[model samples]
Target: MRLLFSADGSSGDLIPMVLMAREFKQAGYDVCVCGSTEFEGMAVDFDVPYEAYPHSYSDIYLDNQKTGYIHNIRENIRHRERLFKGEFELLSKIAPDYDVLFNFLGEILVPSFAEAFNMANVKLFTFPVIPSERYGPPMGLPFVTENKWVNRLEWAAAVFSAKYLFSYNKTIDRMRGELGLAPSRNLLAENAQCDHMMIGLYEELVPPCPSWSSIDYSYIGPCIPSQPAELSDSLEQFLSQGSAPVYIGFGSMRHQNSDMLTRTLVEAARSAGVRTVLAQAGSTIGAEVEGSDDVYVLREYPIPHHKLFPRCLAAVHHGSWITTHLAARAGVPQLVLPQASDQYMWGEIIYKKELGPKWVDMNNLSQRKLRTALERLVAREAFTRHASEFAERVAGIDGAKNAVESFERVKSKLRR
Candidate 1:
């Protein structure tokens, strides 16, 4: 069987999809990945066929940092247009040979692709941000009550943003028209609208609520990749020297004030009497690393979290799915500085679980505040113990393998 893995977004999105693609390939199925050109190297690393989308999604991410959300949405639309111009053609080119298309998040164009190929599509995601009556809203709103109407309105706001505010409906209609598919008003809805199946990358990390029971979805935990070929000698040496340094890395989060943030992290770690190894995961903070007898910043490619995080006393990151879960799996307490998107929600999850500090707003973060939080986090024995127990629980689940098995079952049913 031939499979197409079409994942759109940054490294966080692309890497997991690539790992799942690797699983398919190892299962002796032919596989190809469709994603941003930024992830081409990752695809090559996994020895899979890759088809690049027109422009890098990094443009959208960097633009969001420079501009505001409204401007970011406009730029996203522009990028999507650029993407669809060539994306459809590429899908058409590959449609004949590939039997299935697996997607990450809600690609507005998935329905059109499914229509064109007459193939089954599976939707996989990490966060439970999809509009649901189960949770208040996607961005982790405070629950005022158990009133279902209140929950429904929260979800309505999300749908309104996609369909009206972001103007996704107009663009989606145009793309469907271009593909000769019927217009779709239900393109941006409050639930997983896929006809086939949807899967969550986490297994009850933020377990789905009762309201989401009707949705055709599965919770398959996370796909932890294999350890890197080897850590750099410098990074390895630093890990050996430090007294279980605090792990600081914001995976794929482009900070507007990298210098300030980097300095804050370094000083905060020192003030708390802990060393740090900052993983400059696609951040520009590498050049700002200095004056650090107690700190080492990694600007290199492939800082293996599985290996390095096990050596850290605590973790500080952007509350992305990969980093948060990895830290939990490593049994290290965390400090989450959330910027935007589902990150805010993930930070809250960490806080609620008592495994991390409260979500520190990026706009208002100061050295003093960070130092205090770190000091408190390190002083707490409960955080580390809870994190360790969570790690033990996570170790038993094989998420990537389960996802492939789920896909096989769905494909078999669809074929029949």
Candidate 2:
């Protein structure tokens, strides 16, 4: 069976695809991963056929020379355009060959493309719950609001962009014309004829799946595995010498004032009287701060939370879904500092599950706030016990295996 998997964004987005690809390869199926050039190395590492697509959101973000909020807004606009163009090109090239297309969440173009190709065996996978019309506030707004303003603005942007910027509506309409189907609202509803809808997040994290007659949606839990990355000897030594340092790191998101964040973390660790390993994901946290004796600011590290969390007293992180799952799996108490996106969701889940305290918004972060969270995480023995039990639950599930099995079933269904 030949399966095509496509995704974009950070390692968090690509890692799940890679894990599923490995499972399919092990099951004696030929799996090809189509994604950004950034994921080519990861595809190769997983022994899957790597097809480098020209579309990349990160490239657009980096290409814009501007910094701070303006940079982010410009990047978002560029990303929307690139996403439409890149997905169109990729679909035209690969839609003919694959028996089934498995798309990750945030893949805005797959449904229309699949309809264009008359590919009935397409599956849509999400790392989180599907958004309702009024679920969460719209992304990239000037300010968040509990009122209807944010959602209205979000819908307005979607309409304006679809009409003018990328002509996404035209593209979809054109595809629908080719398929002899009327134009529909959004890709998910339009692609209701798809064979499966697989959700990657666990039921615990997401609310119940939406009931759709044509789509088969199931909660498959998070796909996680240890990937190989190098760790500095000094960092390793620090971890080995002291009681496992509270693991603290923001994966890829850069802090505007990294020095301030680093200092605050250092002070909090000191106040809590614990060693700390700070995973500096590509961004520097300043030379003086990086040179600290008690705090190790590491550049690259292979220490997955599965391995490190067991040794640490507690963890403080940027509240990414991948990081939250890892921390929960390790059964160590967590203190999430949420910035944006699904970070807030995971942070709320951590507190709801009684695994940690409430999330600390990064914008409002301070030494005292972090210190307080740390103190609570360390002092509460009940949190640790609950965490350990949760860890065992995580260990028992084989997400990779399940993902592969699902792919194979879809492949078999397509053949029939």
Candidate 3:
């Protein structure tokens, strides 16, 4: 089968989808990954065919950062407005060439394209978000109470409000109209056109929502690929320098005050007396740490969290799903600084699991606070033991293979 996989959103969104594309290829399917031009190279690295779509993920990231993280209703609405303008006409143009479409957060636009081609499409999402009573409210919203009834009400309100709040009904209808289709009956039913929707995260991190079990969804775990080669000889030597360092990185989340954040991170590690290895995704952290022996800032092409996390005592990051799972699989505790989206959910998971530090808002982060968190994270023996146990469980699950099996089932049903 010819499989077309596409993704858009932040830069971190593309990495796991590329890994999944590789899995599809290995399963003897012809795979082509489409996304912002920035991910073309990633597709090539995975030996999958590449298809270019309009927009640059880095450019989108920088543009989104200008407005800051979605902290309020207005910010969330503004964010969706920006996304509505993203040109997905490319999907329409290429839709007929593929047998099946797999998209990551591409549902908002895919409905029109799927209707245009009458194709089988699946939505693959990484976030542990579903408007179910069993799972509480969606990720970004605060969990107000432990009462299941109250939590269920929050989910209902959030989902109900999203239909109007997104304010994209007319815009999407227009897109569908242009494709010679009727208007979408309910634009808020975001994944309505998808033949299936799978949450591509570890079940441990996000257990299945009990009420949604009979629906078309599955937790196939994080489809993490095999670890790439070690980054560099210098990095290896730096790891050998002292006690295991803290691995810090905020993948692709723009840091407007990168210099200060960089300095703060360095100082935090210094105060905690822990060495640091930082992946300055797009931050000025690497520049700030120049010539510092205690901190080695990696500004390389592709991050190898898989290879590096095992060498670290703890991982500190923006609570990106891939990063957190990588650290978890390595049996390393984390200090999660949540900025946006499902990051807060992962942070809560880490804290609840007793395997890492509590969530700290980036806006409120300080050298002293971070130092104290780091000290507490490392000093707690239960954290390491719990993390190690979790790691053992995670190591046994092959989510990529499981996803392929699920995809095959989808294909078989389509054949029927």
Candidate 4:
């Protein structure tokens, strides 16, 4: 069957989908990934066919950063309103070419696209989004709580409040109407249209599966592709220069005050008496600007996490899904600086798992606070032991293959 792996988000998000696309092709399905022009080269690198979305992800990200950065709910909805109009027009023409639309964390309007185009939908969640009493929804405020009951209450409130807060139901209905279809009967039902969902998160990180949604859920571990190569020679030399440095970088998350962030990381590492290696993803943390021997600012872009993390004392990052998994798989403790979305959830996981200290908010981050967090990460032996144990378990999971097997079942049901 023809499959369209629709992907969005940063390197943390897209890389796993690309790995799955490769797997689907290997399984002998006619598969192609569709998303931003910004990520076309990534698909090319993996030898997978790619399709461009109606609007670029950079434009959306820039707009979010400009218009109050995830706090401005009105602007967020307005931007989605503008783009989904054009997205509907594009998907209408191309969707029929595919038997199934396997969404790799596409925007919220994915269900609308599935409904309007009559596409077989399969949502591949890198992190949990569906409402559940088991865990809190990974978004703004009060995501996790003291117990499952509190989590359940939080979910009910958050989901209900979010629907009215965003007010995108009209946009959904409007998009459907424009396509000469009836308005959505129930938004939740629309979401439930998917034949299957494969959650690409480590099973150890979360509790066992509960059938919260009508469709079956597959708790596949994070799908990590094989590393491209070993670390470059200069990086090798740097790792050998005394002690293991804290690998710090916020993967692809934008840092508005990169200078301030940079200063904080270096100063904190120095205060904690540990060396630091700044990966510097879009943040000019350690880029030729007075970095000492204790602070090594990597000049290389896209350094393999697999190669570098094992050598680092701790992985400090924005708690992106992929970054969290990589850090865990490498047996390194984490210090998550959560900025938005499911990042906070991952941070909570790291803290709860004893893999790291409690996450420090970027807005409130200071040299003193970061130093304390880093010191805790280094001084505590449990964090290292827990991380190593998690890695040992993670090494056995093949989420990409599991996801393909689930899809095969979906295909069989479609045939039936």
Q: What lDDT tens digits, residue by residue, belong to model 4 across residues 1-416?
A: 78877665556667777889988899898888877667888889888998777676657763354212356334444566655655666677787777778775435665556656667778887756666557676653324553777777766765575467556667877777877778765454355457777888887787653545466667777887664777877677878877988888876666566677788888788888998888876555565555467877776766688888988998999888888988998999999988766677888889999999999876467888899998998889999999998898778687888888877766666521
lDDT preference between candidates 1 and 2, better one:
1
Report lDDT (Cα) of residue 290, candidate 2: 51
**Backbone clash tally (model 2):** 0
TM-score of each: 0.91, 0.83, 0.91, 0.91
Tens digit of per-residue lDDT, candidate 3, span 72-101: 334545555445456455776787888777
lDDT of candidates 1 onward, in order = 0.71, 0.66, 0.72, 0.73
Clashes of each: 2, 0, 0, 0
lDDT comparing candidate 1 with the true structure: 0.71
Error of 1 at 277 (Å): 0.8
116-219 per-residue lDDT for model 2 (tens digits): 56564454444332333433322422233223455455545655555566455666566556655677665433434566766676555555523343466655
Superposed Cα deviation of residue 295, candidate 2 (Å): 0.8
lDDT measured at residue 340 in model 1 versus the true structure, 0 to 100: 56
lDDT string, candidate 1, 166-192, tens digits: 655677777778777776765445225
In model 4, state the lDDT of residue 327: 92
In candidate 4, which residue pairs get closer than 3 Å at backbone N, Cα or C atoms, i.e. clash? none
